[model samples]
Target: MPDQSPSSRRFRADSCFVTGGALLALLVVGGLFWAKYNMSTVKEWRGGNAWNLTYEAAAVSGDPRAAAVRYRHNPDSFRKDFRDERLGAIRLPWHTEANVNTGAVARMEVAPAGEGQVSCRILLDGVRVVAEGRSPAPGEPAVCEVTTSSTPEKWPTKPS
Candidate 1:
C-alpha cells in the first residue's frame, strides 16, 4: 500500500468543509422561506376570521343596523360587547345612518321599497360605502363588502 499523503488528506478535509457549509446555507434559506409562508398564511386566516366574527355578531343580534351602530360608536366597546376577542385588535372608521322617520339609531333601512325587505349601507370613513346588502326575507344572510383594508392590518401593532 502506498503511503497516504498529508496534502491529499488536507484536500479531502477542505472539500468536506465546503460541502457542509453549502448544506447549512441551503437549510437556512429553506427555513426562512417556510417562516415567511407561515406568516402570510396566518395573516390571511386572521383576516377571514375577523370578517366572519363581525358577520356572526350581526346575524346573532338579528340587527345589522344596531351592530353597525355599536361598532361606529366605539369599536373597542363593540368588540367587548360581542365577545369578539380575535378582532378586537382591528380598528376602522364606520358610519351608521340614523333613521329620522322611525326614531331609530341604525344604519339599516327596512322597507326601502315596502315591507318584507331590509337593506343596509355601511360606510367607511364617512365617505365610502363599503358594504351594501339587502335581504328580502327575515333571517337571511346580510351581504357585506369584504376588503383587505377591513382586516387587522389597518391598526398598528404597537401603540403610536
Candidate 2:
C-alpha cells in the first residue's frame, strides 16, 4: 500500500497465475475421476433410443447372418456422410470379459435356417449381457447367406 515496486507487482502476478493453475489442475483431476467412475457403469437403453439397424446379405431360405454395430450417434443425423448405416444388433462371440465402447458393434452370426438363428448376446464390460434377435434374409434367392461388416461410428455427441 505504501510503495509497491515493480518486483512486488511481478511477484503478485506470479502468485495469481500459480493459484489459477492449481485450481485448473484440481478441476481436471476431479473431472477425470468422476468420468472414470461413471463411465465404468453400463448404460442400458431401456426404451428410449435404439441402435442403428440395417439388413445385409440375405436369402429367402438358408443360413443367414449380418453385421451389427452400436452407433453413438443417430443414423438419420449423418445418413449421407457414412456409406453404411446398418447398426443391426450387438454381438459378442466369446464369453470372455470385455467392455463395449460407446460406438462398438459386436459381431454376430445368426443362422435363421441351420443354427436356429444365432442369438445376439453382447457382454458389456465383460460383465453385462445385452441381447437382440434379428436375422438377415435374402429377397431373390431362396437360400440364406452370411455377411460381415466393419466397425460402426462412435461420435462424441449424437447430432441434435
Candidate 3:
C-alpha cells in the first residue's frame, strides 16, 4: 500500500541489477580460479613412470637460533624434515630421497627460522644433478625446484 511510482521502480531495479552483476562477476572469477587449480594442481597427480630422486640442502651463516629445511618431490605433500614444535629451531644440512615419476615436480626450500644463508640441491638417478636453489637473502627462501618431465638426464647443471 505504498508508492509504486516510476522513480521507486527505477531505484529497485538499479539495486537488483547491481547485486546481480556482483554475483555474476563472482561466479566468473570462481570458475576461472577452479579451472586453473585443476590444470596445475591436479594435472600431474598420478606421477607416471617412476624414478628415484634425492633432495639435499645445506645452510650456513647460522645464528644461535635454528632454521628449517623443507622439501617436496611429488604432488602429495611437502615435508619439513627437521621440525619439533615443542623445542627450539633445528640446524640444517638435511637430505631425503623420493620415488618420483614423469610429469612430477621436485622442489626443495630452506626456511630460516633465524639469520642464515641457505642452499638446496636435487639429484636424479642418485648421481646426476637435476636442480638447485640458494637463498636470496637472510630472510628470503632459497628454493631449488624442477619438473621431472623436462629430460632430467639431458640437464647438465651440477651443484657446487
Candidate 4:
C-alpha cells in the first residue's frame, strides 16, 4: 500500500540478497569450526588408543650372545601360527617396542644371553607403566605381562 516504485522493489531484493549472503557465510564458518573441533578430538582419541610392549636386556660382560625371547604380542597372535622371530645376537642394553591391541593381554619373556640383566615392560600410550619384570638373577629369564583395558578410562596405570 505504500510506494510501489521500481527503486523500492530493487531495494527490498537487494536487502534480502545481503541478508541471505550473510546467513550463508555464517553457516559456512560455523560448519568449518565444528569440523575442526571434531577433527582435533578425533586426533586426541587416536593418540589415546595406542598400546606398546617393550623388551630390554643388558649384560655386565661384553660377551656376544642371543637371548631366547618368547612373547605373546597379542591374545590372537597365535591365530596366524606365524614363524618365530629372532632378535638375532642382540646388543647389550637392548630395547624394542611393539604395538598391541587394546584390551588384549601381552606377555614377554627374556633369558639373559650372557651376564647381567634382562627386563620387559608394558605401557599404555607409552606414558603409563602397566607391568614390568626384571631378571631374578644373573643369566636368568624374566617375564612381564599385562592385560589392557579396551577404554582408557579403565586402564590400571602406575608411574613409569
RMSD of each: 13.7, 12.4, 17.5, 6.1
Off by over 4 Å in 2: 40-160
TM-score of each: 0.33, 0.32, 0.51, 0.52
lDDT of 3 by residue, 31-139 (tens): 9999766754453453244457787767656652336666654433232232211223555666678755555566666676666777778888768877887778886
Clashes of 1: 0
Candidate 4's residue-wise lDDT over 1-160, tens digit each? 7999999999999999999999999999999999766864564465534355565544544353436776655324223222234555565666666655556666767677777566666655565667788778777776777776655344654556
The order by descending lDDT is 3, 4, 1, 2
Best by lDDT: 3
Expressed as tens digits, the lDDT of each residue in 1-160 for candidate 1 is: 7547998888889999999999999999999999766864666554322321122122223332322222222233223222211222111222333211111122232222212234445543344444567654664433443332333324223235
lDDT of 4 at 51: 54
| Candidate achieving higher lDDT, 1 or 4 | 4
Per-residue lDDT over 1-160 for candidate 2, one digit per residue giving the tens place of the 0 to 100 score: 5559999889999999999999999999999998666542323322122233322223233334333332222333223222222345333331222222234343434333343333344333333334344444332212211111222222233236
Candidate 2: residue pairs that collide: 58-137, 58-138, 59-137, 59-138, 61-142, 62-144, 98-126, 99-125
lDDT for position 46 in model 2? 24
Query: What Cα-based lDDT does every candidate model obtain?
Result: 0.38, 0.37, 0.64, 0.63
Candidate 3 residue runs with Cα over 4 Å from true position: 1-48, 64-66, 75-89, 150-160
* Model 4 worst lDDT window (10 residues): 75-84
Error of 4 at 37 (Å): 11
Number of the top candidate by TM-score? 4
**Deviation in Å, model 3, residue 136 alpha carbon:** 0.7
